[model samples]
Target chain A: MQDQPLHEPQFALHVEDLTVTYGAQPALWDIDLDIPPGVMAAVVGPNGSGKSTLLKSVLGLIRPVAGHVRIFGRPIAQGRGRVGYVPQRSAVDWDFPTTVLDVVTMGLYARIGWLRRPGRAHRDQAMAALAELGMQDFADRQISQLSGGQQQRVFIARALVQQADLYLLDEPLAAVDATTERIIMDLLKRLRDQGRTIVVVHHDLTTVRRYFDWMVMLNVRIIGQGPVAQVFTAENLRAAYGGQLALIEGGAVDPADPHP
Target chain B: MTAVLEALGLLFQPGIVQTVVLGAALLGGLAGALGAFAVLRQQSLLGDALSHATLPGVCLGFLVAGSRDLGAILLGAFLAGGLAALSIMLITRATRLKTDAALGIVLSVFFAAGVVLLTVAQGQPGAAQAGLSTFLFGQAAAILRTDLWIMSGVAALAAGTLAALWKEVKLVTFDPDYARALGLPVLLIEGVVTLLIALAIVVGLQLAGVILMVALLIAPAAAARQWVRSLGAMVWLSAGLGAAAGITGALISATGRGLSTGPVVVLVASALVLASMLLAPERGLIWRWGRAARARRGIAGRRVLAAFHGLAEAHDDPAYPTEEGMLTTLIGRPGPGVMERLERDGMIRRVDHPPETTRHWELTERGHDRAKRDQGGRP
Candidate 1:
């Protein structure tokens, strides 16, 4: 609960000069991004555009070649356990032998402390998170038996169980059923209303404005960053997605137009 | 029958056989407990690679001591296994080689070096490394009370570690990225798990040779997975299954002459895997097959009902009953039993015509609504 300095505005996430390279290829290059607290924000880009890299770098999962990240004006080291992460659904082997309740309980592993098991209170908390996501009925079901949408819900529920102040999700809506998308979006919005910051790595550009209030258009480097109304302009899309997107839309799109 | 009785009775008698059984069982249980993590982490071959890599350490331990001192050799094997695990991890991470390739490379190279070292040790004067190669396919007869104590200590350590870090290990194995996000020491947990797996492999060295040790590690867990839904159940069941297999194999070896315990134990574990796969509830092959058969029958029955409903619609009479033979001819090879099952389920019923002809069947009122729903459109 350390107070921020007088000069520093409280950004839920702040990255300064972040550059990540896999071997000779740079994934994210010299990027600076700031997302204020309590806004449903998005990291928008096409494939291989470092949307995931930004999240990973912010979480300090992948060591960036340069730059440091902060959550709420503090370095990641000092901000530990305050940020919740939902990795890509495909990041894990879904066939692993585990129950839905067990996966959600993973969020509290840090709070449960090292070497200590999750007690009944922890289980109730996990169950409550699952209930929020409408996955309470699947508490005992094995994860592998779930659909893609259910898997995404379970992932979001796991993040919710963490009860972190700042949440970073990697494509929570991708390939999910319509119901799951709405449920997750509602949950994220609820978190935002409660003054929690949620940043999503988003791919579907058409729905970006509708889904997020804050946007950071990214293609290796920052193309645009600010309110979606300002950062989601057609020109920004062209810069972020490049000719690959132009090939699909066939022309420039207006951010105010709300459709490409 | 007498042989079986003798084996069972010999297990309870106080002797070296009991010690060997206890040692093998403890090692098997430890392997099962630790292997659960390795297998869950998709590193089943890590144990295999580490076990094979323990060869040179065993040879070196023998050579250094000029005698087959069990503790020194085990320590050497433990170090070698750790080194092998580290090498495999590095090779996979630093190079383009995949995990299996790294495991294969380390396993064969270390095993070959161990073989060569064994030969060299044999050439040395005053070398008492005879039967050192028994480590290749564990010589259970060589197990002593002290070996049992070692196995017990290792098992206790594995159990304690698992108890302390069960949640963290599960989180890491399932998703390390999230574990890192939660500020858990993902790498440290992984290292500890791998180190324990290596210790388990080294302990199992005397019961299941390097060639068969992987069996003890994987079989029990694989089998337990079929019968359980939770990781806790899987690990506990796997460890228990492993212990049971160990005791059974040791007992069998005692009842017979010239049967190697390692291969016997491995065979027992393999049978457990096979049995679990075939017979475990819900997830088992037989149960799956039965479910599949039922599904196929249900689909065929619905198709028949829909077809019958269609025929009635074409005839513009909802009660239009068709000859059984015609229905069979039209459906063409959905067995006669399929329609009978539909009738039994009240979806269809048999009827008789005024003329002396074969009985006819027609969709019931409920079946008509179901068929229409299945069609998803009006006539």
Candidate 2:
């Protein structure tokens, strides 16, 4: 029940003793971590390694059997407006009858309050977000007509319109073209430069060194988590991906590291 | 013509015909607005199941009240539909059965129970169940002035609720998990939407009847879906279409002899659906076919232009007037039709030899430029 300043918190996201189970099998087990503010962190893991589950649990989309998550030194509900979320690309019905502008405007729903529609100021903000993503020309286009990369950009635009301090993206780079990947990476870097924290569930290890500063490797449990230069080693990747680690040997880790 | 005019005249007069028309319109508007959510959520059959599930409650109301009181019947229907929804949720949650299976089981079982109760009520003497069977396939002529007042009140309440919660409902329908993450009371919003759907189904029973009420719930919204690209527009368009269909069916039924209102309304709604499916601009079948046809023609024209470019490249001349026979050989057979189309498009020119019937075809300057770009300076 501690009420503290909104901007100052020990960690951008803090998870304590978190364990998530789907019926009998465990999805994520007893995880504890503290993500510092203003770092672009990648949650890297193999398929079915609970990367998405971890993000969902942190966002309060899924409840853990035992443990709690705090964002900016408070429960998620207390600072709901300060957190932005971009769910997986396949999470929504793309064929739904909605325009790009309308989807972007949804990010301001929490701020707009109940029973009140978004006004011109909110719309201008959404347009600005779309412009930032180079999708302003497609503002009125139906979402279903967009390509996979454009769709991903629109999702990012929605999250950008939230103007939140902490952003959680689930596989934002998956299935996107090279240009879209670069745009997203640059946008994330700019957010970090502006003192915002971004946590993305990333798959490609090759880009981890270039795109992210911090990393969290998971295989139903925390494998390693620290600065990317320290924890993102071939050894850690082998542990997270298990024996399926092919073509990832040699020079995958930082050369300066002595952890060979 | 006179019969139609008389029916139209009767529609404006303050009597049973006018009352029935107004009641049906209100039912349609409310059901349409609520049903858009159902359609978007891909839960159209849930509305069917819930409406059919209302039958047991209607019989229970009759058995309890010992009379044909509209309020009691509606309340009974609401309760039964709500219980059915709860049971469906339980079965789906506790077991491995999917939503469709659960809904089917609940719908038929509840409807059968209602039929048994209805027979029991009819066997007992002194019970007023004379027009009770009309709830199955609605008798518009049986509508009373009192029913209109209730219908209007419920319609206003339901529509107002939808307007007030429009944003929350949109978010939940679009992405429930994200709505939950936003801490927007996702469960409460979903529960309200479910209750409103049940309310819509209960109110529509008297007008559309239990068996065919799902048409009113789904058809108008689905039709609107074809014509619109935003949820707000779709909702309003669906409501308008539903109201129109309701009024049209009522007017038609008034003109005909011994025709029931519910089936006529369903038919009208089905016709709107068919029209929308065929004629809507972007998503309609007709529009898609037309676009595909245009694309195929364009592809053929491009292929002919590319063929011209290939012939020019082989000769290393930008304005090579290749013989018609050689161009035909390059373009594959059945080439004259495509050649004519290319000529019409101004991409190629035809040069006729005066003595011989044979002609020469060559690319125009514009066509040469296009050909060069197509060949990407390969030559």
Candidate 3:
């Protein structure tokens, strides 16, 4: 193991003037963002808010229209085997009759390259991953038998098996039980402690303050992004979550004070 | 029958038997393995289309060389079958038409064109022209030693490729999205799986014929799926089943004169599928019936326990004593036979001290745990 590399104290992933378009409609407009290493940062927004698109651009799954995304000073492709991705749970059809262990082992496919079978070492690595998520009991159970939370955990385990320096998880907590949510949050904290950067697409606003240390408040564009306490305030909340802004902003008032 | 047996005995000489068995087995195994992915991915119909599409290429090959060289015919078949697969892919991707409809459209049109080509080829003066119709019914007896060698070599090559890419194939077929997210070349992997299917169908066309080759690809795989859960297991099972079908078809056709080997082989494969459907452990009819019977027994056991639970909750004093009517109410169906059955099972006992015509029921120790687990209240 080597010492973690550093670009700056407050930046791990850097996106410069990123823009993407689907045909004529711009899915993402000019956007610039930075996320430092070892922090659980979130890209929070509503539907079609470019939250997923941003992650895809970073992963190089979709080519950006106009900018570069660098992982620790190198392009994403050069960072292969160092970045892990967990796509949305709904993005895949679940009725294909594969077990949890079978799916988790897919993480090794890229590492092994084409035309080679996963050897004994790969199976051992996969089992370690399953045990990490406490899913060893269901390892042989078909993926379709899993609840939403278990499926999400299986995806996380797959990412864990990748052993990447940075993890990009999309809506991992969505539709999960509270215990599963806690487990994921704890796993993210552990990953961060190990000096890995984790970028998550989060949905639950209530738990966001407690769960994340940094935030990329987005609504088709960045509202504000930095430390959660200072950067995520009433004004930024209003900009990002427009209609519910007052409800959130109104709760910010100190209750003991009589004056506005 | 004796004469047929004697004839088969003559053909069973080591050289001939070894050639036919090894050739058919290799061919069957390759087609079956590739077809597992095709059937799993719901592209079984593509096998049909590609098999028919090889005809024009065969004609083109004959037309080009004016000879029946195996190399020329194989090249032509590969080109035409591959083009057919590519066209199917393009149509589905470029148009709103769904896969099944597009496959149907392609299959009929290409097959009709092949029929027209065959008609035209009948007037052509060539030695190769004699066996063009043989491709339709598959002349197993006419499989020369050279043809066997080519088929065996192609089968080995295809099987090797499949084994090499098995994991990638399974991943993409199971979940293309996850494969894409991991930066696996999904299009390339899919193209490989498709190409393997096309290659299998093309190679099989001369042995199994266009009309029945689709059956060869799908039946063994579909049959194998009924018996296995893992992709590896399914592939192995499919290969075994296919080899068996091929050998049996060849033997029967060789021994019994006037039978077409291709249709016989397909029929053998279909019979395997039907047998698996009826007899497999997980999804078969027998297993399903067994499960249903067990469920009925569980429900009967629960009804007895429900009667006991009713008695335990009956009185205001709640000392757990109740009359006969509670059993009927708790069970949700009024029947004298249910009470009698419950008593016979020793799950509940009829009260003897009550007035002669009426009786009360109470739980045995076994009944308590059964009821608790059912309600999910406790164990």
Number of the predicted model whose lDDT against the real structure is largest:
2
Worst 10 residues of 3 chain B by lDDT: B313-322
Give the DockQ-based CAPRI class for model 3: acceptable
Candidate 2: TM-score of chain A is 0.93
**lDDT tens readout by residue for model 2, B1-379:** 9998998899888998898889878888888888899999989999999999999899888888878878898999999999999999999978879999999999999999988888887776645545777888877777788877777887888778878988889989998888887889987888888898898888888878899999998999999999988899999999999999999998899889888888998899999999999999988999999898777776677767787778888889867776767756876553336678778878899876556578777888888777767668453
lDDT of 1: 0.86
Question: Chain A TM-score of each model, in the order shown?
Answer: 0.93, 0.93, 0.90
lDDT of 1 by residue, B92-157 (tens): 888889889999999999999999998898787656545887888989988888778888888889
State how far residue A139 of model 1 sits from its true place (Å): 2.3
Error of 2 at B1 (Å): 2.6
Best by TM-score: 1
Q: What is the lDDT of residue B339 in candidate 2?
A: 72
Output the lDDT of residue B75, model 1: 88
Candidate 3 per-residue C-alpha lDDT over A1-260 given as tens digits, one digit per residue, 9 for 90 to 100:
13445333355688888999776678788888988888889888767778999998988888887987878766665666778889989877665557888889999898888878788898889888988788889989977678999999999998999999889999999889988988888888999999999999987666667888888988878888998776666677667777866555466432223123
DockQ of 1: 0.80
Runs of candidate 3 exceeding 4 Å displacement: A1-10, A91-99, A112-121, A140-145, A218-224, A229-260, B1-11, B14-23, B88-109, B126-131, B134-141, B166-187, B252-257, B308-346, B349-362, B368-376
lDDT of each: 0.86, 0.87, 0.78
Instruction: For residue A114, give model 2's deviation from the true position in Å.
Output: 1.9
Q: Any runs in candidate 2 off by more than 4 Å, and if so which?
A: A1-9, A247-260, B126-128, B312-329, B332-340, B358-360, B377-379
